[model samples]
Target: MCLNSLLFFRCLDALVHFKHLTSLIADHNPITENCFLPPLPKLDLLWLNHCKISSLFPWVSKLKESCPNLQHLCLMGNPAAPSYFNGGTFYEYLQYRLFVISQFPSLNHLDDRKVTEDQRAEAQRLYKRPFFERIIKPGSGSFSQLVHSSVTWSGFQNKLTTLLGKDKPNDRNLMI
Candidate 1:
């Protein structure tokens, strides 16, 4: 079926036992504001780059659970997915792994590997909005609490950059 803003995700979710869904470009659409992964049970090669999503990489784990042979995940041009890492902590590294291992355990390359200042600002802009603060899962506390609990945007800019400036590439093959 032909996909557009209203029916794309609905169609994708209804497709049972999907094997692969590559390069899903859903830009310039209103649905990108929320999570809209296609839920491919056996998917591989996702390309959600530049979508204005606000999930803390939930699809990562979902894809991992479905696609055993998955590789290459992309989430660029969003505020949440940092473009360049100023620094990361042991906790950040562990959280990244935990989020991945649980779902994208077999993923090879996660695209959009850069966290620039503007992206952080962009992410901040999204966070600062009134809708996001009141719309996400409750008990997440206020915006500060959620940001701190999320990925890098959580909190650590102070020590993160100085702490992980020399750290090596984190390559852990997790199995969750």
Candidate 2:
């Protein structure tokens, strides 16, 4: 099923009805990082490009749990992927790919590239030890807190804009 460019702010709760679904293209939607997705066991491919997803920290785990069989995944154009569109550096993008490949061992493809064995091996080598553990210890006031700590002020404001809706600014103008 394809749901691209629909301006969907959240994961559609209606998708639970498609039991036999194998592929889903949900690019260009404003889906947030914390959106809860229904399980799709048969799902093998998923595209989530150009979304609001930032900080793949816990989000990858959730995707793993929800789509155990997912082989092909695309996260380009999202904050999590760190593409040039968001001023993400090459190093950051490389790290993102390694981290994603580490999380989804069964994944065969990511974004525009096929997951090469060399990349997979490198991902394993880099992420053998949980990366977050080195930065923040246990009981660090939640994973979201860790993610929020690194976000720039502008990024935080952008997240707020997404959450409250862009119409909020117009509403404020009407009060005067």
Candidate 3:
């Protein structure tokens, strides 16, 4: 499905019922990071080539949880591209610098090209700061407080264990 060129487009709430949608072309719209509050679990291909996107990191970071199965993504002509690639010199700096591959670990093809394993590894290493900031800082409050809060830690651990399908501390199968 394509909703391209809708200049004033703000949200994607209209697509919530399209759970089976595998591909979407919503380029040239004003889609933002908050538009993906509800996930599109089955979406495999997404085209957002040219739009008002200012940054790719935040959007793709949120996308990892929203569209987990996304394999093909296009953000080539957007404003965010330059910020991510440093004036579109990604190919020139490919040997020494990392690109967008690190943001989405599951992404296979970006801008219509397959992401190499080496590129992925380098991106991960280079973009570790952003990743850690998202987790440790997470927009507000102090890192020390976030880490020291037992309620927060327990909730986070429970969520992680649930996602990994592992039993919590009380449900552990101890042999001793």
Candidate 4:
């Protein structure tokens, strides 16, 4: 159902009734991370563009589990998606795409573009294992502790640069 421009400000818990919903367009709403949509096994196209999704971590994982068949997801204007219009650099946008594509390997389309072969390959290379799964290894802290920690962009960038082996002189000092 098209629930666009409804000014929905909280979790859409009511949508769990539509177990067979194949598509849901809820763009232009102020939906936040609290949205607790339940499993929709048939959902393929979900357009939450121009909403207020701010982070990708829990949200991506939740959606991956809830909408396993989802193939097309448009989150263009959301902060989580990261684009030039939202003050994000092209590198950030590419990283966002890589992260999403890596998480949703079955996804065929994202935002306004199709998933390309090169992008998929790069995603695989970047995310050999799920991002969250890497948070705990031997003696590392729990994922919740990491989540509540003060995560700075520079620190994240430094780790990513090290992982990609793209280290440059003083690169760790640069913040996106």
- C-alpha displacement of 1 in model 3, angstroms? 19
* Root-mean-square deviation per candidate: 14.1, 13.0, 13.6, 7.2
Q: Write the per-residue lDDT of candidate 1 for residues 1-176, one digit (tens) a residue.
A: 44553544422444454435544444433334344344564555666655555456455444455556556666555444544452444454444433443344355665534333443444343333344543444575777775676555434453343333424355422211
- Candidate 2 Cα errors over 4 Å, as ranges: 1-9, 130-176
Tens digits of lDDT, candidate 3, 37-118: 4588999888886766665555766777778888888876676665344465544334222455765677788875788888
What TM-score would every model get versus the actual structure? 0.40, 0.68, 0.59, 0.73
Please report the candidate that would top TM-score against the real structure. Answer: 4
Off by over 4 Å in 4: 1-9, 130-176
Better of 1 and 3 by lDDT: 3
- lDDT per model, in order? 0.47, 0.77, 0.65, 0.79
Better of 2 and 4 by TM-score: 4
RMSD of 3: 13.6
**Candidate 4 lDDT over residue span 38-78, tens digit each:** 99999999999998899887788888889988899899999
Cα lDDT tens digits, model 2, 55-159, are 787888888888888899998888778867789877777878888898888899999999999999988866755434434556757667867777577765665
Measured with C-alpha atoms, the lDDT of residue 32 in candidate 1 is 46
Candidate 1 TM-score, C-alpha based: 0.40
| Regions of model 3 farther than 4 Å from truth | 1-8, 83-88, 91-99, 128-176
- For model 1, the stretches where C-alpha displacement exceeds 4 angstroms are 1-11, 14-39, 57-59, 66-68, 84-103, 112-176
